[model samples]
Target: MPKLHALELVPDEAGQELVRRDWQALRDAGLPSQLDHRSPTNAPHVTVVSAPELPEAAVDVARTRLGSLLPVRARASGVLLLGGDRVTIARALDLDDDVVRRALAVRVQVPDRQHVGWLPHVTLARRVDRSSVQLALDVLGHRDEVLTLTELRRWDPDLGAVTWLAGH
Candidate 1:
């Protein structure tokens, strides 16, 4: 799979700590977690749009349109296991319809962020081992949280960098 650029919704300080605590818990349990990603740019975020290539124009448009809808109330629904063999454990999010609508308006061809069937989530662990799935689940139960997504940022994995688009 090719690397992708993404527009992500960043949580406030308190919300971030909530996620970090989860990461730490998984780490303490000797399970795969976002903490293992090892990049300074690696942080908790709900991806709104992603594509193999995102142009500067597209980024600017997202900054203007999506940025205007700052401070969205996002509910961390629960823990979800995505993918087949190497599962991705994530915290599902329940966002407003308008947020989903504007995300599709970005016109990105990424299926994961499509309006028809988009499962918004903030990933906790990537490619967790099958043997650790049950353990990870046990470690991180169905914990729910109400988080305020306060910032919009663009993630360029190629550069290992993030460009803050909006919010305090």
Candidate 2:
């Protein structure tokens, strides 16, 4: 099976703590955790860019070019509502100049934010009640956080297999 291409960010200590707290709070507040809660499966990462429906060749190209761009620090600002009650409380990401230029270079033919306006976020919870929005917000509060991104890791979402985009 084919897998989507994503950039995995290695979170700093503070970022890690924030995610941990958020995960626990969401569970306590009667919501299920997102995928990353299983440490063995996924790491906490801001989706630098995601493009759907690409050929195998493009993915191979992405894997090659991702390392060309130096690692960037992605900061989180506020909460993003992914329709219904699916919400992600986030720390902000300041897409650096090096990151910007290379993100474009590495951009595939996906008709979305892969080209512009990439929203970087750490998901707090997913698929909770609309009535529980405030509860989720209350748990997250107004947290200003900074996550330093190092390398982009290509992952097989279906199989939960990952390869580090380190050396070209």
Candidate 3:
């Protein structure tokens, strides 16, 4: 079976901690119960690239491309409504050339033109009702947080998990 895999920017320790606290706060503040199977171990990450499946060589290619790159600064600033029912507040991160090049190197048949356009973002929540989304937005309005991209991870299909491949 082909695995669904993605190359994502994993958050550093401080960022992960902040995300955990924020998620807990969001849940505690009566945001609608949206099921998130991900954990602090998984935390939150911005996808650099994704593919249905790639050859083992692609992993090497990704590693090689990512090995020498330095970390970039990213920030979360606005709320995005994906479709009517799905909503998320996201942080926008600056995309470096190396990140884009590495993402493009991975072959993925993404139909979303936006995805192909090198827009990098990390989602804070999904499956959120309008009221909950609005509440989140109100809570997080104009808040700025700095996050560091610490590692590159691949979503392994066989294991149905994300694994650390390389760090820069």
Best by TM-score: 1
Q: Give Cα distance to truth, residue 147, candidate 3, Å.
A: 0.8
Tens-digit per-residue lDDT, 24-49, candidate 2: 77777776666436648455666656
Task: Give lDDT: candidate 2, residue 139.
Answer: 74
TM-score of each: 0.89, 0.72, 0.77
Better structure of 1 and 2 per TM-score: 1
Error of 1 at 140 (Å): 0.9
In model 1, the runs with Cα more than 4 Å from the true position are 107-117
Pairs of residues at least 3 apart in sequence or in different chains that clash in candidate 2: 74-93, 75-92, 75-93, 75-94, 76-91, 76-92, 76-93, 77-92
lDDT of 3 by residue, 24-115 (tens): 66677766322254443456787766666556666676667764464655665544556475665566666656667776765343432234
Which pairs clash in model 3? 76-91
Clashes of 1: 0
- TM-score of decoy 2: 0.72
Q: What lDDT would candidate 3 get against the real structure?
A: 0.63
Overall lDDT per candidate, in order of appearance: 0.84, 0.60, 0.63
